[model samples]
Target: MNNLKYSICYISFFFLFMLSMVNFMMMIHFIMNNMVIFLEWEIISLNSTMIIMSILLDWMSLLFMMFVFLISSVVIYYSKSYMSSELNLSRFIILVLLFVSSMMLLIISPNIISILLGWDGLGLVSYLLVIYYQNLKSYNAGMLTALSNRIGDVLILMVVSWMLNYGSWNYIFYLEFMKNDWEMKMISSMIILAAMTKSAQIPFSSWLPAAMAAPTPVSALVHSSTLVTAGVYLLNRFNYLLVDTLPLKILLLMSGLTMFMAGISANYEFDLKKIIALSTLSQLGLMMSILSMGLPDLAFFHLLTHAMFKALLFMCAGVIIHLMSDMQDIRFMGGISIYIPLTSLCMNISNMALCGVPFLAGFYSKDLILEMVSFSNLNLMVFFLYYISTGLTMFYTIRLTMYLMVNDFNLISVYNLYDEDYIMLKSMFILLLMSVVSGSFLSWMVFSYPYMIYLPFNLKMMVIYVSLMGGLLGYLISNMMIHSMNKFIQTYNLSSFLSLMWFMPNLSTYGLSYYFLNFGQNLLKIMDMGWSEIYGGYGMMKIVKKYSIFHGVFEMNNLKIYLFSFILWMFFVLLMLMM
Candidate 1:
């Protein structure tokens, strides 16, 4: 049975890898030839309306599909070892396959209705995956994840209904024509809102971290390529409608705040997976803000490159967690590099890539994004948000590295930690290779010409400067200790706010629902148990009882009442006859 489960994983890994290769080649072909193929299947036609399913085969979709398949393939292979002891490993693998298929459906779709099919599939499957552990935390996280994405699903449905104006569901064809119209603005606004919910910008950001209840393999696929990126991908496709629009401007501000907020939040985070999840959130903000700047291509570039390293980072974290007896807190982890050198090496590489170290995968894209930010005529607030967020990226990365690699081992004295699991190591190595080379490869393939960036020397060095300062702070802060008292207690409120993602989780869950729940309780008291009960069931019972009492009185006096009535009738009849 275990062998059969393993075989299922291996077979999935093989086919997905082959598909990724094919998609990669096709993406290159489409890019070189500047071609787009739209295949439409008409499901129904009524009057002047048509419900057609349209598939868009372009370089962008193909490239994204390739990356999705590649990461999914690696994640599945890694899960075989990660979940080897589980009795229901086959169920896990099947869910992952379903997720990948849904993502593919989303990528190929150019119609709103079809997109919703894929969109809702992602939400539902993700909810299932999040609660895979069948624990309280997993259940709560799954509900949060599902409900948050449901907002997006609803927005998409609204867009579908609004698109009925065109008598067709193929939104790609109407993007330009609808750009200047009021209805188009409404549609675009809804689309942006939907995307924001899925990508988890600002108010919607809580679910991404909560979703860490999912298995690490799911995190690797969902956070890195498929689920979170779906929103960004949708926005990128609709970039034309967003140019010089109010919704785009608001998205810019929200995404910037989201990036900065996540970076700050990650620094204060202790959980290994949550910190990584927060970093994913931060990178997502960067992609969104860039896309909002009217450079969807650059956003797409960063998205692809980010996927390579972020997935690798999660895989490394997974391996470490597995070996550490499921210990996720960084405070209990240190100097594991001495015990498991290969995993540490992979972890360090991925972390550096995440921090945008020179010449690595992230540098090619992140550095370009910073330079582009400098080139654009943006305000100081936006400027600082971008640079500071970059620094915070380095800050958390350095702190995380120190905690896991540099410091002394703070866990049990006697334990075995070895990097002998080749199945897991092999999967990590594939992503490790991609994390090193994918940036430059994608830079060359995606863009025909390099961006022309011109900036002053100070602005040019801003990213490096902020990064160095952030790294320095990270090192110093991690080394400091508070004697005789907990440091967080000294600044309880500030620490609470920062560590808790600015109370976003609280606001999203309790804060938003508190009033509604309170109102519901009031309704139950005043309606269901109060006026409603009186006028409804309780009142009807009272009326029925009163009638029953009146009937009982009549029955008790029945003979006396009958004799009196007969005497009155006889006297009245005699009087009438004499008249």
Candidate 2:
């Protein structure tokens, strides 16, 4: 099959899939036997301590490794057709493999020091991938992504330093001890901060949306499954120490606000990738919030399930973008289903799953998460945020669907519609199946006993009510037209603020850099060009010249100069003796 050469990634995909399957079985066996297998190598030894490279082969790490491999394999196979036109196909595939390897490193390591190796690898490789297009937009997005992730890198390095005090860098062993110590609590706070940045929580969120400048497959892999989830995975690991703490409560507040913010922003978004990016942000906030509520298992459950559907969603978007000549504006897309029905089917399924439609992938995790939030002792603000965010998710999904699937096609010609790309379709089908089945599969595997969420009639129906209202509003908003074309001018400022993510991009970029840049400019002016020139270098030359000129005058063969020099020398000698 020479055709298989074009899809070389499929070979790698199958190989990785087999490895993942094996790991899954091993993990299950370990879980069943109540055992953990750790492999350690003492790389270096200090007095009474060792710098160790350790692999943690337990249910959690193995399970996550299996998922990572599963997703990466599917992504690689998907990329074969997606990037078929590119000249440097091998480079792209290599980057994807490197990314997968780094993710694996991150998954298996229990030591903080070893974890940094993987964490920084992800940041570095993702930066490269984001800039793969070599355009100005991609460059800017790459810088933002790298810098945002670099903050986490620095934090993890600090964590490594903190772990040094315990004479061991293995945080897996120290989480319990660290939970009780005040000093260790500070360390835990840093870890949470690192997680927040990686997860794009609150202030660190500007980069995630900006990173949509990359190719869609990179977005699918990095944003959906790997890079962003690293933070949640880290927090999942540290959930024991974080439970019921003030830091975790802060996480809850920020995460809830982030969820609400991204949801609202997605409604205002027009770009296809950006809307999905915001949706991912919203989902991440949901995961972080659930984890903050002391439900790491629920958070992890949502994390894995979200990875499946969101990746599928991005792949579908990629297919649409390719079909429409790289057009990513939903406003420019309408009635796409009439052309590419299969892709549209996958898109709708993913969208419905995103909205937590009952029995879909999102429902099992999202509904459980929301119900758990309701059962917890939460304030009215958080309560409203959780429900409203859920509604906003549906709002954006319905609005997106209206723009892409229901409205009339806006293209100049109908002949441009060609959807039969079996290569792309095949990869999408793989994820489509997972998006439908992964939720039920994970729910069964992760929980031995079913959770009974007992609520009153009104409370039980809260999610459905919000979801229905959200859908209705989305349809109305998408269809509604203004009496005057300039009607939006009245609310332009408010809309712009919400649409621009509260100017967070500006804040993260120019706002953060303004002072340092200003100070540098001032130093260049006053120190380098002004003061140094006047006093240090040029000024010293001027003083020396003046003294030399005076000395020449004094040494000149003139009677007046000789008398003046003698009088000055006599006066100087008398003054020196008096002193």
Tell me, by TM-score, which candidate is best. Answer: 1
* TM-score for predicted model 1 compared with the true structure: 0.90
Q: Can you give the lDDT of residue 157 in candidate 1?
A: 96
Give me the runs in candidate 1 sitting further than 4 Å from their true place: 481-490, 514-579
- The ten-residue window of minimal lDDT in model 1 covers 481-490
Q: What TM-score does each of the candidates earn?
A: 0.90, 0.88
Report the error of model 1 at residue 51, Å: 1.5
Once fitted onto the true fold, the runs of candidate 2 whose alpha carbons sit more than 4 angstroms away are 1-8, 481-490, 517-579
lDDT tens digits, residues 31-58, model 2? 7787888899999998977999999888
Error of 1 at 481 (Å): 8.0
What lDDT tens digits, residue by residue, belong to model 1 across residues 129-243? 9999999999989988887898999999999999888778888987887789898899999999999999999899999999999999999999999999999999999999999
